[model samples]
Target: MRLRDLLIDIEPLRAGRDFRAAFIARTVSLFGLGIATVALAAQVYRLTGTTVHVAAVSMVMSVSVLVGSLVGGVLADRSDRRRVIIIARSAAALGFAALAVNAMLPEPRLWAVYLCVAWDGLASGVSVTTLMAVVPTLVRRDQLPAAGALMAITGELGSIFAPFLGGVLIAAWGAGFAFAATAVTTALTSLLLTRLRPLPPARSTDGGDGGDGEGDGHDESGSPMAALRFALRERVVGGLLLLGGVTAFFGVPVVLFPELVHTRFGGGDVMLGLLYTAPAVGSVLVSVGSGWIGRTAAPGKVLLAAVLVSGLAVAGFGLSPSVGPALAALVVVGAAGTVYGILEYALVHHSTPDRLRGRMAGVLTSQQTTGDIAGDAEVALIARWFNPGAAAVFNGLLTAVTAVVVAVAVPGLRRATLPAEDDADADDTGADGTGTGADGGPGTPSVPLGTGPAPVAAPPRAPAAG
Candidate 1:
C-alpha cells in the first residue's frame, strides 16, 4: 500500500556483483539481438526481393535456435555455466561481425547472410538459456522476483526501441552499420561475462539424490530430457508450463491485429503500428512499477489472476467497436501479461533445483518459442475460417477459461508463497521435502503444490531469443 512499493526494485543489481554484470550484459545483448533481427529481415528482403526468401531465412534461424537451446541445456548442466555463456556469446559476436562484412560488400551474398544468421541464432539460444539458469546461483532465493522484473523491463525496452533504432541506422547509414553495431554490443557482452565468477553445475546443492522424485533410479541431471522427466513428476511445474503454453497459444493474437484494424476500424498503416506498440507501452509502464511483485505472499494466485485479466482484455479488444476502446483494452492486456510473465519466471526458478536449472531453462525457452509460433498460426487459421474479430473473441475467452481451470486444478500453484527474507544459503526445501524455517525449523510455510513438499526455506519458487 505504500508509494515506495510501486517502484521497480534494483536491490539485486546493487548487492550482487555477478548479477550486476550479468544484468548489464543481458540488457546490451537483447538490444543487439533486436537490432540484428531487423537488419537481417531487411537485408534478406533487399537481396531477394521476395518475402518467401525472407521467411525461409527466418525459419532456418528458428530451427537453429531450437537445436542450440537443447544442446545448451545439456552443456549447462555438465560444464561450467559461466564458460558456456562466454563461449556462446563470443560465437554470436563473430557471426554478427561476419554479417557486417557481408552487408558492406559491393555484392553481398545472400548465402552468407543465411549462414551468419543461422550461426548467430544458435549462439544466442545457448547464451540465453545458460544466463537464465545461472541467475539463481548469483542471488538469494527471495531476490528472484526483483531480478525477473528487471529482466522484463530490459526485454520490453528492446522490443519497443531496438527495431526502430535498427531501421534508423539502416536508412541513415546502411544495413552494414546496424550489423556492425550489433556486433560491438555482442562482443561487449562476451567481455562482461568474463568478469563473472566461475559457476560450475551443482550436482547436488542440498545433498539430495539430485533428482526431484523418490530415487527415480536414473541420474538424468546431465541429460536434456531430465527437465521433461522432472516436469512430469512435479505438478506445480507442469501446471506452470501449461499456463505459459495456454497464454502463448490463446492469449497472444498478434497475427490478427492487422485484419482487425483494417476490417473493424477502417485503419491504415499508422493505426496498425499503434496497435502493435500499445501492448509494449503498457508492459513498460507495469514493469517500471513492479516493486510490489517481490513482496507478494501468494505469487501463484497472482499469476493466475494476471492470466485471467490478460484473456479478458484481449476479448475486450476483439469486441471493441472503436479504436480508442480497442487500444485501451490492449494496454490492459499488456499490463496483465507482464505481471503473469514475471511471476511465472520467478516461480519456475524457485521450484527448480540448481542441478537441473539449465535444462529446465532450456525447456522453458523451447516451450515459449514453439507456443508463440504455433499460436500465431492457429489464430491466423481461425481468422481465415471465420473473421479476425471472432477469432480474437474466441481465443480470449478460451484463455480466460483455461486460467480458471488451472487455478482450481493446481493447488500447489494456487497456494505457493514467498517467505520473508531468509539466510542467503538456506536450504529452501528439505531433502525429505518439507519446509525448513529460518532457525532450521518450521518458520513460515511457502510450498509449491504437488512438488512432494513445500520448501522448508522459501518455496522453490523470455523470450526474446528464447
Candidate 2:
C-alpha cells in the first residue's frame, strides 16, 4: 500500500524526455477536450432544442471515430507511431479551429457543426488508437498496469472538472469561446508533442522468426486484412473486444442521463453538470485505488467484479426515485466502470504482441466506438418508445446480461491473471496473493474469470532502487 512505491514503479517509462512531454501534452489536451464535449452538447441543445438532433450528432461522430480507429490502427502497425500521432493531433487542432470559427458566423450552420464534429471525431480516433498502441513501447511490460492506472487517473481528472468548467464557460462566454479554447489547447498539445524525439519505425517480419527484435515474422507487404484477422483470431484479444462491446451497451444509460434529468427530474444545466460529476467522482476514487488492486488481485477477476458492480449500480439507478439516490448509484457505477475500462486496456496491451499493438488497439477502439454508437442509439430508441426511466432500466438489464454472458462464455477471462510484477519474490502468488497455486504460468481455467491463461512470469516488480 505504499503510494511512493506505486508511483516509482512507472518512473522508468517516464525516464525518456519524449515520453514525459507526450504525457503532459496529452493531459492538457484531455482537459480541453473535456470542456469541449460539455460545451458542444450544451450549444447544440440550445440551438436545436431536440434530443434527437443531439443524439444524431453523437452518432455521426461515433461512426467517424470508428472508421478512423480502424484505419489508424492499421497505419500504426505499419508506420512510425510518433509521426502518425503528430499528424493526427495537427488534424485535430485544425478541426477544433473550424469549430471555433464556425461558431462566430452570422448564422450558425448546423451542417457546419456536424462537419467539424465528424472531422474532430476522425482525428481523435486516430490519436487515441496511436496513443494506446504506443504505450507498450514507452514502458516495460510489467509496468503496464501502473501506466494504465495513470491513464485512468488522467481521464478521471479531466472528467471530474471538464463538465463543471465547461458549464461555467458556456454560461459566461458562450460555446464559441469554449471551442476557441479547445483549439488553442489542441495546438499547444501538438507543440508539446514536437519536443519528443521521433519513435523508431515498427519492425517488419521480412522472413525472420517471431523472436524478440527479429520482427513479427510476417511478410512486410502483408495485407491490411491480416491485422483484422489477427485481432479476430487471437483468443485473449477477441474475448476482450467482445467484453468491451458488452460493457459499452450496458454503459449507454449514463450518456442519456442529461435528457432524463431535463425531462423527468425537471432539472437544467446545473443539475446536468452535477449528474455528470456523480459518476466521475466514483471513477476518480477507483482510479486512485487501482494501483493497490493491481498489486494483489487477478486483473481479470477485478475486471469481472467491476463490471458486475457497475451493472448492479446502474440497475440501482433505475430503481432510485430521486436525484440523490440516482447520484449515489451513479457513483458506484462510475467507479466500478472505470476499473473495467482500465482492465480492458490492460488486456489489450498484454494480449497483443509489440508489432501488431497499434492495429490491435485500433480494432479495440473501433469496437468501442461502434458500441457507443449502438448503445446510444438503443437508448434513444427505447426512450422514444418508453420513458427515460424505462431506458435506464433496460440499460441496467443489458449490463446484467453482459456480466452473466462474460461470466459464462469467456472462461479464460474469469480467471485471467494480472501481469504479475516481475519481482523474484512474487513467483508463488495466487489471485488473492494468499500464496499456493500461484505459479507464474497461466492459472487453471475457471468459469467466472474466463479461459485465458495466467501470466507465465512472477509478478512484475517495481524497478530496483537506483
Q: For candidate 2, write residues 77-115 as lDDT tens digits.
A: 667777888899889889888888877787788898899
What value does the lDDT take at residue 444 in candidate 2? 15
How many clashes (backbone N, Cα, C below 3 Å) per candidate?
9, 24
lDDT (C-alpha, whole model) for all candidates: 0.78, 0.66
- lDDT digits (tens) for residues 1-466 of candidate 1: 9888889988888878888888899889888878888999999999999989987898888778777888787788778999999999999989999999999999999999889988987997898788878876676667777877888888888888998899899999999999999999999999998989887766453344344333547667666776777676567878888887788778768888878777888679889888888898888998899999878877888989999999999999888999999899998998898888778777777666666777887887777767777888898898899888888989999999999998888877787765456543464432122233221223323244554335421112152232
Model 2 ranges with Cα > 4 A deviation = 1-16, 42-53, 204-228, 262-268, 383-386, 423-453, 456-466
Candidate 1 lDDT for residue 40: 90
Each prediction's TM-score against the native?
0.91, 0.82
